[model samples]
Target: MHDAPGLVAILAYDGLCTFEFGIAIEIFALPRPEFDFAWYRHSIVAVDRGPLRATGGFMVSADAGYEALTEARTIVIPGWRSRDELPPHALLDALRQAHERGARLLSICSGVFVLAAAGLLDGKRATTHWRYCDELARRFPAILVDPAVLYVDSGQVITSAGSAAGIDACLHLVERDFGAHVSNTVARRLVMAPLRAGGQAQFIAAPVAQVPRHDLAAVLEWARERLGETLTVPQMAAKALMSERTFLRRFKDATGMTPKAWLQHERMARARSLLETSALDTEQVAQRCGFASAESFRVAFRKAVGLAPSFYRERFGARQR
Candidate 1:
């Protein structure tokens, strides 16, 4: 088991998103008797004065204030009250100091706005909910806003897309701190998938929430099954029985990514799975993922995952642990 990760401070304020706030509590604060080792120690820190109002017509009282952030190893910012509402100056200052002292800051949903307002996300790649991505970009031009991703893990600052994507980012942190085994166990308790790659698309064109386009679902499924093969836009378009131009537009509308980008994400996702679960060598994994060569795979994997395949395997592989 890994050493205990230090205190986690979850901020509470007026107009709180109860769901997002609850996510932090569930992942970090909940007692985990399943593990013999110590889990995260958490505290709710108040961003405003007494009797803060939250969503669903309830009030919350925090255990501490901004000062609690100082000793925290990690801080979670739940969905902000509004995109336009700037965070309190004191709260912003506290966050900046916490970050300067090397505390990891995790922002969920609209909470990215708070980080952006605090200038913590300057010159860094970040993502927020798709609806706010454009506004986030417009408001903070220095921040590289990725609308396609479920989350952006920029080392100290991790930002997640809307709502449930916060669960993915939190589980990812647990994996980083402990290991895949521990994270997967936690996921089982939560009844959720063990992990979702942060690079996975967020489906910006949410016609019916998460429902896929009927015309493209079959083609997408076929393409996913054939990730090891050389698939092209035209091939996908042909499979979908649409003209190239129409296919391209429809694909983006359905998936919020170009065919090539989607393919890369799928390949990388498969590569990550193989690295975590398989005994295959790097070259074999690369071949399975349709990379021309192991070297090409190494370059691409490092670029996309921020880690080499071997190192990733060593750190996350079930057998290695």
Candidate 2:
């Protein structure tokens, strides 16, 4: 947690979005003593070691410039002024050095441009705001830009979609580093959901189906209620009263994932909830989630979430009072 020699450095550039910059500061820089653990040691580092003006007529001074990148364990690049402009050579070098030294790098919204310019995202699967996805992909053909996701965590480098998705990315970082409980605590303080289902497309507008299709919704609800049961696509399709092909098509159209993928995600989510909120062991949790065995649950959970179930619960679960 906070006891670790971890410094969270935010890259502050001239003409940066004050709101996006503020999101990083609010999440990482704020002091919280109730948790009885030290949170991140935070600092604002300018791209150039000088006073910088934010987008909305406010100026902020920083402690250090690119030099601060070397000392940081986690580097956060919020939003840049423009995507067309490249980051300065000095800043790019510093970012490269930090990454080479094993610092976790993050870019929120348009900040992906900085990482892209630095070549950190050259061959990586990354994302930015949905609006800039086309531009980002077009500019850097080497990078795999997935616009449908809210955020993509490719180990040391993480990039989030626009605006509030940055909050999700930051909380995800906290969850990854300190565990789920700490993340949930911080998320509660911020008055936002600890987790969001599906992808960025869920937030976008699309043509609604002309037919009223309550069947898909009903089947999903049924599956959720019967998570402990041996649920399969055939069972789900049967409940929806459609052929498997038709059901799968409509399911993907509505939710952007197949029924199997959605079920697995739901199962993992339920496993996390039970892990955090109850005293259930991994075995019970696995059974509840229809994973058949604790070993299976562990493998699936780690594959989906990048952490083991026990570790996730330890970090996120509330202590028994």
Q: Whole-model Cα lDDT per candidate? A: 0.87, 0.85
Which 10 consecutive positions of candidate 1 have the poorest summed lDDT?
A: 197-206
Top of the candidates by TM-score: 2
Question: Which runs of model 1 end up more than 4 angstroms from their true locations?
Answer: 1-4, 31-38, 82-86, 130-149, 178-213
For candidate 1, lDDT tens digit of each residue in 213-254? 447779988988998899988898888888899899878766
Clashing pairs in 1: none
Backbone collision tally, model 1:
0
* Model 2 lDDT-worst window of ten: 312-321
